[model samples]
Target: MQRFAITHAALFTVDPQDRVIPDGTVLVEDGRIVAVGPAESIEIPADTVVIDSGGKRAVLPGLVDAHSHSSLMRGVTENMPLMEWLPYYQLEHRALTEEDAYHSARLCYLEALKGGTTCVMDMFRFMDRCADAAGELGLRVNLAPYVADQPGKDFFSTREENKRLIRTHHGSQSGRIQVWMGLEHLFYCSEDAYRDAVRCQQDYGVRIHTHACEQREEEDAVLKHFGRRSIGMLDHYGLLGEKTLLAHCVWLDDDEIKRLADTGTSIAHCPISNAKLASGVARTPDMLAAGINLGLGTDGPVCNNSLDLFEEMKFASLIQKATRLDARALPADQVLRMATIGGAKALGLDGEIGSIEIGKKADLVMLDLGAPNLTPHEVTHAGGNLLWNLVFAARGSNVTHVWVDGRCLIEEGRSTQVDEGHVVATAQTCGLSLYERCRALDHLRVDMI
Candidate 1:
């Protein structure tokens, strides 16, 4: 019967009404939010540990990274498009040993926690290690071990490995970690593999995750191979549905968008990665208008270079506005929702997490409003600029505390579960060794020595 109370904070409940309680309190019991309302309205029990915020902390649902990858390639690859980048990325995957996989997940998850991402949907290789790291670190996660069956795609996790991961890790970690069916990509799979993915979904009650329409050339490539466009081919294979999450629909037609909306398929939009790879800007406004369930994703560490949802939120809005030439497109409030509840919806976990509401899981992030960048938040009154500053101006450095399942994993901007210094030191050694082992140092932008 663990119990706690967080009081005198500005609560951004991204609920059905979009409620923002200026001075609120939330009560937690057994990892669930038992009560939430204005500070004056809630009664704190004597047995509960109280966290008084002094009315200078802004609390919101922990940001959901709808798409991510556990990798050691941050700052290791650059200026390569999706197709051209695959070989180099595959090289690293081939060189990665099991120990390297664990360290990579540690580094990536540490970064994610420091940046206020409490839940993540990660699709990458050697994901059993990733699952172990997530369970130890206390973040909610969905692991999708990258799976493929085509001859050239043997570098990815096989279907057998995917099944093993599902059986071993799904619903593990006290229901905090879930394993999904991860298909590497539409082009990377044979019809047999697609059918097997569908079978995994039906048999295990898990969802399918894959990249689709990421590059401008993908439409033609998928059409040439399957005799149908990317979305159409997915539909033909019975892949588009509520239980499927597609990453980066950057080149979809209006009809395809309609098909996605009709099927209730979700999309994870990784704007920074898309721009980094020079993939064309996705028609985000069009997708939103078509009622698609879309959310923000930071992609892999190498592609995004960071997992901070704050940066992703700003870019997610600005890119849409700039590309659509409409200043009102993807405004601050909507982008914030996309990072929070919308992301949970995309991952099919909205009911449990994503908002500071009664009965929801007590997964929350608290930012110090006293930070120089957040100085003028003044969230105690209406017309406060807190929400606007949060999306447009605040950085991950402002995050002071992070809680998942009523347990504080990061307090006062430092982790309580693992030694950050050790994680960084080990990751540096592992990364350099991996690059050297693969003879990839020569491929770096500058000479090593």
Candidate 2:
């Protein structure tokens, strides 16, 4: 049954007791979420398909960036850091093609599906044209093809091409895509490619994304080439457990934050690409008081020039209260549960798509609570301030609708699948022909800092 529902909204059920519900509703069917609360208690049946949103709309749970990268070299590599921006991003990722990685994954999955972000984790380079541009723009991806095996970063992606992109796009589109198992740091691999990417994450049960201790000279060049430090050389090659997933540990220590909360390893905290490449801040409230599992990333629209997870949940809570000057560091309901269910438990996909509850998978988004900076949308059971105006005055142009498994690929504000002005004029003509092939391979470094 294809059902639907969504009624007079205002929800924000980042559940497990974080419920917010005003007039709420929900429902959905074949795409999961059997029903949520309010609207005078559930029951909107009689052959579904409703969508009322008259409570001015707020909804929630969709976000989840968890680390990204499907580059188009935004604003042309300004200033620089992270080792002088990796040779101008490996010479514009070696002048990409495969139709410029399918129009840079259709301009970063159409700016992460018009910014309400319904799941990402991208890690790049021709990801089977970023899984056919997230199966032609519906979002919920994982891909992760940037695998590298050292020796001058052998132009990334390998480990038998990340096991043929996990046997050709793991759980393909109907499951909204996922592939994982990628590595591009800890000195770009080799300890037999980190034991063959932790034996390709136990031969494809999937999971293992990379980049750790994101700076402090990449943990002092992985502690002078493997005397251990990028999380103790990724826990000395067994690649520290719970199906791995790092990405800017931002130079940890406190025994690498208790070895990533003792191997339940997960962290994608890319606070504005580590404060726009000066690369330093992530100890996300001491890795969430050492229990770890933090999430919220906006790491690449070419170093976050923008794939707005509501400006990465308002700079992941004003850079943890301006670097822990502590006006209640990382609050706003724990940075909106680290951008929706701790970014679907940092990409393991939290029992199938972060919160809204019921049986899950309905994805969601909504927003536009009569815009004007979300008017005075109340419902934090009345004390209001609507989760601090959706983590400090929401954006992504107040989203205005977007669904995932239940379909509505963005509504009141465009895209019911494609043609967002011919995907931003074909990513501005393949980002000006990969910026004149990185200024004819001199890697266009317009020295400015």
Candidate 3:
């Protein structure tokens, strides 16, 4: 087993205790954290590879993206509401080939690593190809194939296909990659599909992920379909459980919030995507107060246009404050926790990978503070100020290194495993072809109208 030591750096554990160790050293042996303490206390082994951070960096647990689509549709659909956006997104999704999915996964993973996100829960079509790309790129991915079945058969996967994917890819990538049962939305799926999704989750011991209450239209559709709201309907169908991770509870009411808290369900809050789509701000402060485990997510490259969780954290904090008209809504430390420990809790990986504790996997990110935005530092309120700077000032460019399971996948602000140039070229070509196809379909729709 290989051994490595990262020494003489500032460390933010984001643990339950919220410990920040100045001039800390973390020792990793065979992909697990063996020791973490002040640099003066820990003895460096002669055979260990030492990473000298020169006290110019702040190391923290790698950021976890609790929800994402991993599609190359960044900046594609715009100025549309949920109902209109759904059909347009579907038209574009139908244009995705296996190669397109692969390249998109590569591109998304590259962006994620560069932005200091080490783990992601990605829901997309053609997930086998996505899984392959994540495996090759050494990304810690939880892959959920989009499963939707409706009466019209416009764009969705059937129940049988969802089961097949779960069987094939669960625990596939040496335990680095996991597959979950997914649905695009409750309205897009039949009652039988919902039941089968729950059954698959029980049988395979994996999580169920889906979008719920993203917009008022979604809520109205659920009410029209079942004479009840989406959360109540999901509860009636046995879909509300501890293993469920619901994305975007922006339109949910107090009753829905109570239901989620009572059922121990998790939420992936995407403030940036919500704002960009003109979706209402999620009541994250209320949800957190109600004991809901809230994690940060970028939603998708298409809607969010970037996978930077630091930006998401900043947006999450500012939006909550602005919406509530209360400055104390989401503080810097709370936002930092939401990006690290809160995300791990929502993903059900809290026991293994959230903080820099001994016996935990060494998934870490190093941010260089030598830049202009981070100078004139002060140690008093350092944790709070460090988090504020990270959320408000830092970008993907500030992330110097990223490690997952003690393996260096990103070094010096670049992906070590994937070819950035080739991935970008392929995504560009595929995106152009998709645009042309959508234009042709628009003409057909116009003629029909």
Candidate 4:
């Protein structure tokens, strides 16, 4: 319940207009923003903590990771196809124990928070422990325990187990930690599992998260088996809705795009992961044009190898431009929205935490504008267009501080919750030990060709 008055910041409000206020002031009290605007317009209380941005610093809304997985296998799954890559890395990583998941989740949150991400939509196995880790670290997390009943692909929890988890952690930690229904993929789940996804949402009023049209082969397989494309198939099962968050709609067609828009479904585009796997570029321009809410994701650390949304934001713009042969296909402003407001909208958390405004949760990030990478050029009439510098040049290392719900989780580029040294050490040990245990399996033992 700390009160603070943040002032003298080069603020990027990221509202509907993406207003850049030269010197702005934000008043935060009890984990919510009381006022936000030019310093001349707001009154400051003498007793509040005054965080003055004396040096070159920019304040913006905390970045959101629309989709991610808490796994410690970064740099291990390289150049594998989408289908093969899943079982090869993810299934093998599922051997994680409660402690392993805890450490892994801690590492994930550590990196993401340091990189200025305050919220994450994570689909991982053994997520009760994952929820605990997120709650402990103070990052807003949406947990969807992976659920699938197919024989060979059954690497998820049961409906009953997920319900128990929902009861245990859904609204815990002041609603900062939540649970949703997750089907790993339409291909991985049985029809019964699909029905159960609806039942979970209907019974518990939770969101449904799953993977959709990620690769051509996946779409082909779905068409052969279900006589419909990805969106249409999911729609048939009543799985596509306002709360449905589908990841990697890379191979969708025109009609499917319309279906997504019509169903009020959202997309979490993982540009780096798709490009790394040689998966085709998603129809992002069309999806946006069709009124679909699209957000950015890092997929899994093992696939993209990093959770830096700054990196994801750059790739999200460049890939669309290259694919469409239109340099203006995806602009910096749109990409920034995808990482911030659009991400909140996609998760249905928009009313609470996306942009900087009065009454919203005080989730914010501050960047060192003096960083060498952000210097020289890109200056507009008003100082510099930070949206351009942030997306094009600034790296995660440029993040100076981060706050979620008015709590400063990271300050001066260091995590305050867990010791980075210990978290890194524990993750390294867990990863090595987990890799050793899984090496006996044929999937882990096989070398990718």
Best by lDDT: 1
lDDT at residue 433 of model 2 (Cα atoms): 88
Clash pairs, candidate 4, are: none
Candidate 3, residue 5: lDDT: 97
Candidate 2 lDDT by residue in tens digits, 101-220: 788877787778777888888888878877887888877888888877766566667788878878978988887888878877755667787788788788778888888777786677
lDDT tens digits by residue: candidate 1, 125-244? 888888888877899989988887876566679999999999988999989889999987876788788888899999999999988999877677777867888888888888999999
**Residue 177 displacement in candidate 3 (angstroms):** 0.7
**Tens-digit lDDT string for candidate 3 (189-250):** 77888888888877879888888888776688778868998898889889998899999999
CA lDDT of each candidate? 0.88, 0.81, 0.84, 0.85
State the displacement of the C-alpha of residue 288, model 2, in Å, after optimal TM-score superposition: 19
Each prediction's number of clashing residue pairs: 0, 0, 0, 0
Scanning candidate 3 in windows of ten residues, the lowest lDDT window is: 440-449
TM-scores of the models, in the order given: 0.96, 0.36, 0.96, 0.96
Tens digits of per-residue lDDT for model 4, 176-250: 987898887766688888888899899889999999888888889888888888788788898988989999999
Better of 1 and 2 by lDDT: 1
Runs of candidate 4 with Cα error greater than 4 angstroms are 377-383, 443-449
Candidate 1 stretches greater than 4 Å from native:
380-383, 440-449
